[model samples]
Target: GEAMDRRRSCGVADAVCDATDASCTEGAPEVVQTTRLYAGAIGQATAHLAETRLSWESQPRNIAIFLRRATKELIEPFEMLRDWLVSRYGVRIFVDPAAAEELVPGEATWTPEQRPHLADMIDLIITMGGDGTLLFVSSLFERSVPPVVAFNFGSLGFLTTWDFGKFRSSLTRIFEDQSHLNLRRRLHVTVVQFDEGDRPSQVSEYQVLNEVVVDRGSSPYMAGIDAYVDSQYCTTVAADGVILSTPTGSTAYSLSAGGPMVHPAVTGVLFTPISPHSLSFRPVVFPDRSVVRLQLPQSARGDAQVTLDGRVGPTLRPGDCVVVSISAFPLPCVAPLSDTHTWLASLATVLHWNDRRKQESLTSASYTETIAAARRAGEAEQAIDGGAREDGAVFDSSPTASESLDDRKTADRRRGTRRDRDKAAADGTVARSPAVARRPRHRRRAAAMEQAPELACAETIDDIESFMRHA
Candidate 1:
């Protein structure tokens, strides 16, 4: 009603033409329109001022909805968003071929394709699944990708941080040019395959949000991969495989393969080896501009397989190589306003990075309680023992000291008995010298000393005085 009132008061409604008319194009002398308004009617396009970034002229009119799967759960939301977007704001929709039947009259179906100038065709990309769905969308456009707004539906939603519940408001903000965009770098990998003649046969290119892997798939023998950086020989990885990743992919397969977790904002490439046979083959970080290449030696026995973002690619023949570097166009993921720390939060939430059990804090109350408990324990021991000694030394008054003294007394008695038996035996039959008949007088006196009372050692001053007097 308000928009209609504004249109009526300015007489703009009188000049408005049928949005679906093929003759009425933006900047056409027939339309005579001052502002660039996107036509949301079927099979129609309006000119964009700013191409990809969110701005007044870059408002998303043709939004492509990509889902992780064609399940009922995702299809329902797809239809709901389609209805809400078209009915309220007259936004055109593009959907997957699987969900084409659910499209309304004005809404259109979208098919994924490998187009270079896709941004010129579509204004925005809205993904309704997990990070994998977003990766699939990223893989669609080789260059000039539109801004993507991803909603979390799958598990481990590190990349898909936006909630579907607040999608309406998010889309509103995006249309109003008020939403924040998290731009993540992607790796562009080109694989050049060679034939037996050592000549280039085929070249395949891919855009990966995660790591590109070259591994010995199902092969018992180790893979011998020669790695290089910017045309300089780096090292040969003799292991299961090697992974080249972007900083955005650092936390993914590369990290699992013993690669360092580089921040997404960092402009670097990660070279990680998977179970390398050599102990010295460690993960290395190369500049973003540096082109890292992985190749199989010509003397290789088995072919090494290549995988880009978990999708299997062509096997690399002997002398074949893969070139990896930063992509030209970065992926603009829609996140919360000022939520640049979402990646850090994902590290803690999803990956459980640096997660540890919190230790007990030492507070004054706890310390005092511990001291009181120790004092009470000492008091209980004192009650059991009758009283403590006046000596300042702890070992002297402790029960352990008394128990040890008893042990010494018992030991002395055993020694005395053994000596007395050995002496009494005529043939020295008590496991002693067989030739000895009787022991010496000094030996007998020593045995008597060993058989003395618990106070024999004069452990205390009073015991010493009493022993001297008795002697």
Candidate 2:
């Protein structure tokens, strides 16, 4: 009874006792009202933007809706953006002509002739689904290019940049025109074959945003492969096959096959060996503009399977060659408007750099401390860069002096040739001025030399001269 009375006096709720009053005693003071902080900044910002007016009439924007075909999970993300846009800017949502009516039904207007093909009508393309969906959308455009923003739904996606937990903030930022753009390289592939009588057949081409691989098609025998770069022999690979991948794809199959993890912004191709016989045959990176060719030996014992991105291509028989080169265009990916270093930082953080033992070494450190350390390191890097600039001034000046010396040499060469021409003209040996002699030098020589041979007669000589002038 004493304990119960004490608990009641203190306004403490006991497990065995039932009470529903602000104060334990009738005359006791009521508890003071207090508020708690809410970590819903993104949610609140998104709601605020939904209610605000959009400036599209004066700003005039083009929008794209990207969704996955297999999962159909991006409907919510798309609808959220769609409703917000209609409520604010009165922007119409366009869909694929064949799939528009059946897939997307809304208050937005559409025209048949002006179908939104992602590559055509839309200024920006939004991808909803996994990395596969992103790849599918990226494969649509052939020549002209547009930017894409991918909301990830795939597992282990290197291409998708958005996090599900922070999507609310990401969406709000994008809608408010506060985001970054990450650029990536793409590869173009062409498939060719011979007709029944050995004549060249029709050509089929594919554009891939990732990689193109050629390997033995589940055959028991090893693939006979020969590779060339710029018509120069690189190597004749005798392995499962070869993978010609872009920097973006280096983290895909290339990485699995012992290739480096290249950043998407890097302009290069990763030539990764897929299960090579030779230990010395390691992966190599070539300049972005290099043209790589893979050929199957005529005496090859097996047929080769070619894969573009993940799709399979026709089997390549002996004597067949696959040519690969970088495309003239690039794929523009949308990201948060942050420092470029953030991408690498995200990879390192998410992947957990160093090793398990090293990570355990820092287990006691707070996350805040780690972040502060990173920031301090960044500042140190800036200071080092400034020092490099100051120290490199003399090194930079040397290049200018070298360039001036080359320019002087060129000028002296020109001046000496002009003086030689002037001296020759004064001696009456070569009467043409330097400028006249320089003009059409080859053409004048050709005109004098191209005359048809004379028949050792005046009449033949006259006819030959006439023919040379006319020719």
Candidate 3:
């Protein structure tokens, strides 16, 4: 039988046969019941037309590092992903704040100026830590957001779509053919404090990718939250906290709070309560373009905690309010090659979520076994990196001592030259004579080297100059 679609009017008219399929010729066209199907389709089309379109742009060669500062269990997966990225893309990885020291042991001894530029030049940002670490790194970007691929090694990963085992394959797919695969959506938030009359003040704006949670912190009673949708009073929530999450955050704290699981590609926001005292206080999904305003009652007994994504926000006073809306710019994330539905299905399969049999299987995998597997994976990736290079030049620590000494001497000489130039400039003296400028600091050292015929070193001044320049 052919599917028959029907249309109905909300108030003005009755059900009508919108369309018919000849495949069901034996029976009359089935009159389905829906609210103005054609009109709904038209409206949806117009809305999408008005919404900002996204571009799939090319990304530069960049390396991704999985951060693991928030949780201990995340370290194993992070190391695995790091090794895999380095092996496949030849991209250097940087760990989180706490692990950075161990990952680059010599960084502590090096001056800030002498530190390698790779840290700042890292193109891709990946965080294996919880949402907190992801939020922390996102805030680090002053202007533009770098593509961040988060792998959730924590209890929740609403923003993170990939797990440890599948991440390597997903990443390889992204690097193949130099394609950019992530999609990002950002939220524009405005912090507000009303005047004596409750008028909102226009202030600075910020963009977040995950969610913004407002909560009453450490109080005996629930905070009174008054919500408004585009100036229309929505409801008053008597709860410990309220969460406004993006589609990327639907599976995070929002899910724990009883919110519906929304796919990442869905353009909408989820509003869920942390713990609502009333049964009617269920989670609600709003249109992506809707503006949500949250204000605490002036007569409330305590203050509330407001967090953006996971970064800390100012305490919400009784009369303070926050305005949240879809940001003009979205945080572009590289989605693993799999479509959103496939990723969701894989998440269910890997996490053994919502299924008893799968949960039992997940429980069967021991923590120690997982760690061992991660380590083995990392070692294998290192081997891959060792073999990937065309030229077999390997970096060894044998010459490190000599290299450091030479670097120090060269640095000292540069500092001396800079000081001499500054002193001359401050004194308003004329430029140095050519002979003085060309004078060598180690005349005795040069003489000694020249006298040693068996030194196997060049005696030419030009040769010495060339060596110094190269150093």
Candidate 4:
């Protein structure tokens, strides 16, 4: 009843609807129609394990399934899943021409040339394998991209969120209720070929899900690239290469180049120099709105090449420049409702963030006790030689230590003797011998002051001033 109501409200004619249905006559609300879905697997996997194909006769909603080539092992599971999707959900299925012969057997298939037409009609995209497979699917849709639900079937699944084991539950939730999606920004790259006069002659553009790299392809000499941000000259990079990355790409190649790990939600571009000749030239983060241009200098010793998301692009001559900026259309990635903070969890798992040996902690009480014991031993040794004469029965000082102290005393005595001699010479009195002069001037002054009790009584500056006044 609900299905008929939904179909009828979506502008299915009253002729198609039951005429006796009371709701069809009056105030029936309009409903949004769910349309065709596109699903595909990466072509590069050696063995395709999935089997079973959707039956053409019993399907309801239009669906397209893409595959590379099917091996004997893959044919059963592939067809089984396809049939299940169609029979359970009543979806019409489309297959790729390349794998249609092996998987579908007799079903008519769409070729690669029909991708443009297919892109327009597809309501959603389902990708199997890793992040690379998802990237391939994104490339198919040049214009607006349908939301992608990626299954983790390949190694290093930084982008793929759905697990193969829970595919049924994950798909059920998506179809039953609309889920929160992560909008990952993509980069728009333009390669400009400069003519004889160093003017732009030809332009080629590409979309990158990850980073764009400008590198010295095979030359022994470093790549010399002049970098500019928002038309303002930034710096000439002398390095193996330079990586221009988005926030989503920051965790990819840019992270390996010592760039900051930016969250996917952050709107920014990252510039990371690879093996930079100058240590001062490090990674820089720019606002998403900024236009980044990297040009190969005329003096460059080697041919520099550009790569978009690890896919090699045009090789640059001396005057060629590559312009990179954020694209207006972002990729809508369907996330599993179970794990909301997937990025954080992925960092811990994929990057081995928690893979560390447990460190041994010090026993605080034992450590403190050990330190105290050492200190007490030193004090006990000093106490054993009861404060004796400087050179007799005292704590045994090392020869070097004793010599250092004696030298210091000798220098102080010499200084005191020199001062006393100068004062005696001024007063027309004979200078004392070295033995007699060993006493410091301050000690002698103190003894002289003691002889006059009044001066001795003046201990402070105020008392001394009063004594001086009386004298």
lDDT against the true structure, per candidate, is 0.67, 0.60, 0.58, 0.65
Q: lDDT tens digits, residues 375-415, model 1?
A: 76666445444643332323233344233566455545544
Which clashing pairs does model 3 show?
181-335, 182-333, 182-334, 182-335, 183-333, 184-331, 184-332, 186-330
**Weakest ten-residue segment in model 1 by summed lDDT:** 42-51
Q: What are the runs in model 3 whose C-alpha is more than 4 Å off? A: 1-66, 70-98, 107-122, 128-132, 151-172, 178-180, 194-206, 350-471
Clashing pairs in 2: 179-337, 180-336, 180-337
Clashes of 2: 3
TM-score of each: 0.65, 0.58, 0.52, 0.61
Best by lDDT: 1
Clashes of each: 0, 3, 8, 15
The numbered model that scores best in TM-score is 1
State the weakest 10-residue window (summed lDDT) of model 2. 33-42
Q: Residue 276 in candidate 4 has what lDDT?
A: 99
TM-score of 4: 0.61
Q: Write the per-residue lDDT of candidate 3 for residues 149-216, one digit (tens) a residue.
A: 66676555645666667776766554443223334455678888666787765454666777899898
Candidate 3 has its poorest 10 consecutive residues by lDDT at 8-17
